[model samples]
Target chain A: MSLETGTGAASDPAAAPEEAAEADSLGDLSEFDVSSLAYGAVGTTVFLALWQAAALAVGRTYLLPSPIEVATAFVVELTAPTTFTVPFVGASLPATRLTANLLQSLLHYLPGLVVGSVLGIALGVGMGWSGRLDDALTPVTRFLRPIPPLAWIVFAIVWIGIGHGGAAFIVGIGAFWINFYNAYAGVEGVSTHLREVAASLGVDDDLTMIRKVVLPAATPSIATGIRTSIGQCWMIVVAAELFGAPGVGFQIINAAQNLATDVSVAYMAVISLVFLVSDGAFRRVERRVLAWRD
Target chain B: MAGLSEPSASEPRSDDAKVVVDGVGKVYESERQRVRALSGVDFTVDDGEFVCLVGPSGCGKTTLFRTIAGLEAATDGEIRLDGDPVTGPGTDRGMVFQEYGLFPWRTVRENVAFGLEEQGVPEPERSSRVGEMLGLVGLAEFADAYPKELSGGMKQRVGIARALAVDPEILLADEPFGSVDAQTRDMLHEELLRIWSETEKTVLFVTHDVEEAVKLSDRVVVMAADPGRVSEIVDVDLDRPRERTEPAFADYVDRIRTLIGE
Candidate 1:
């Protein structure tokens, strides 16, 4: 009986040469469609118009400041607080101001954003990579995750005093969990077959395999976490400032105490603007880092 | 599938006949029941031979491949590669699963170079070898493409190329073309044969298609479930570029079918 040994290119020289040619017919990589951009533009425009209309309807600036008043207040507060003057319908309205207060607010916001994000990412990656660690730490994480960031204010003030530390602590509490959950979920979501592929290829050790394979595979999820954490950071910034410190939240509270509703609404507008800018920056970074995902 | 004259009495044993599985059996325990995946599965694949294990679904073909690859432990009997027992997955044996297990995140070049990278091959050499393997699979242009972007057939080809790039002693494939369409499967079979002939790596391929087994194997080992065991070992005495409709091909197929009570 003859055997089909398979090692016979030299012995039999005339198989289908066309198959190799046909392999070349595959198409080039295509780009994402522009339809998504159209959808996004339409959604954003509708949201902005609705927000402006709602503010106008509320009328009592303190309860809900109109968009135009907030814009005018923001312009006046931002320009040369040394000689700040508000412009309203071709008339100037002099107002009380504090530029140093903006800097104080930023001090709290920046530290909380950086510290909370770093710790959260590290904790999440650690928990994700080790099942033992996950078992040991999950209860603590779940217990803490459900508690609101503001709930930590009492402890923050008791431990670190009632200024920047307390506010930063609250902000960190808010940002930390968003990043932690995302990173953990990302690592857990890594494909089993991909891990097997790595193992079968001689990357049998967990550490090396994680560094080489799991880390990159889980990056998209981690990136999502970072983006979400940025939004959370902004949300907590005002809340943290509201607790004490002299940021935008404190300014809003002060305006309310003085019964100046328009000024309070103006600060809220600034917060929204800051959030939009931060979101834009994050979107740019996401595009560059995840370019390979396409 | 035309038959050839039998080897002469003085004919020397081909160099490819090196893999020896002597009375191998595997029994897996699942909670409360014992499933026999293979029993007395004996076969010898020459050093560079291409053997296909063909059987119906739930048969022990896949179990045998896994056992040989050292991915699954055998319950009874031994499998010797060259002359050593396979303890675990090593560089000596490369495997290709039916699902192209390419990392979706990595580029085509990276997936092909994964094993080499694990071996700690230098960067320059790794890059060159990756390029060469990609070329071999006719995917050189897609070196930077992600796995998600490739067609099913293309992904499987990369899987095969990745397995081969490591220069393993044997390739254990578990229904490697099972996920693709009929046309793609036929194309892959041809491409596989071409690669096998060129590289001369010992291959133990698993498949449920009778015609595929006849076309690709020097020896088609038929298997059955329900206390899984080797039903028949049919020597495919057909020449290269096999024609499926030939009488000898039908005879070999009939023999296997009869042995399996099909």
Candidate 2:
């Protein structure tokens, strides 16, 4: 297995140009062996065409706005400015609707994601490593895991009020459970053979064994959990903002209420674009850190 | 069984013996069933002696090896090293596994340096010792390479280097060459013999292959299944680099094979 991966890694540089040449061959449109990017492009074009035809058939922009109308709304949202006041200093500033909304959403997302992920990983690794802790907490976690993040909105509203803090609490709940389960499973799946090897190598105590052997062994699994949460928290972000949080999700709901369906679609696309950027960045970091796996 | 030597279970421990397995036994008990894997297994490995435990699949040779290594506890008796009881695993006995248990995330140098690092051997000394071990294993050129970039033979070489890095008194190898091909296995046998002679460390090797047992050890401890026990211990009085094609070598292999009912 190691030899096979070594040869594959060695040949990757030579394989890249051939794959690029295959992808660049636009003349063979009927061929089924194009690159995945080309296939994605073809699929997206077909989807847009189908969507345009459906919009024309409906003949109602208020219900299902056409792609062109949504594009126009996206441009307007990107360019139009809204007044924003800086807290404590009481300075008013003008910022674009897209920029202000994105900033507001990030204010709720970043802190919640960071704090929740840390706490989740700590508790997960603790429970997974110690059988006593796992036995003590398993029943409570099993009961709480089934409840949705949105169900905690009532507590969020009562405790933190209807703002970024409240929205962040909901997003944090989602992030916590996703990361908690992944880290727990990852640690549990660590190989017994590796632990024995560590033991024979002079690692006598549980703490030293866990620090040197278990953590590195379980890193790939923990990384997968974090990556999943990176995208999953975005979903929670939109659901979190549905009440009264001043973010892109809030704009989506507010525009839909005013019969501006195109604006709602525009905000939805913004969420997707942010998710794609964050997910892609995280994947690059994952690949670099887990380069040994290949 | 006719040509085989007497069972060494009755032999008392000598003063020069580095490891003594005194009536050691292991039983695995669960809710469903209780399995006696080893029963009153006894052996002694002298200082700097190379010994091999060979048996059938269910003979508990591995269980015995792991018990001696202190990775598992004996059910009835105890294992002593240098006149001291082995309560658990320690740096004094380094282990080489069949699966080449090198840390996949670490480079060859890091893997070799692991034991020394745990021993708190500081920087320059640790680096130099790791370099020496890698050179001894003929893997100095691949020191910076990860385990995934190496072949099976090379990985096992790293495993050996890692085991030897801590300067352990005993080297416990559990089928270290079992995963490699025949040619690689032969080469590793020569390498292991050279290392044993150079380091003067007592080696307790376990394998199911009769030929491997004959080729590597100063004595072969033949084991039987159905509650594993020592069938016989055969002393090989051959010289260094013994010829496998010789009649005496084949005689020992055949005698051990028959003793195991193969």
How accurate locally, in lDDT, is each candidate? 0.78, 0.88
Q: For residues A128-225, could you state the per-residue lDDT of candidate 1 as single tens digits?
A: 98999999999999888999988888898899986877888887877688878888988898887777677778887889988988888888988887
Model 2 over residues A119-235: C-alpha lDDT tens digits? 888888999899999999999999999999889999999999979899889888888988899889988999999889988898989899888988888889888889898889988
DockQ of each model against the real complex? 0.40, 0.79
Per-residue lDDT tens digits for candidate 2, residues B157-209, read: 99989988998889999998889999999999999889887888888899999
How far residue B189's Cα lies from its native spot in candidate 2, in Å, is: 1.0
Off by over 4 Å in 2: A1-34, A83-94, B1-13
TM-score of candidate 2 relative to the true fold: 0.91
**Model 2 alpha-carbon miss at residue B164, Å:** 0.7
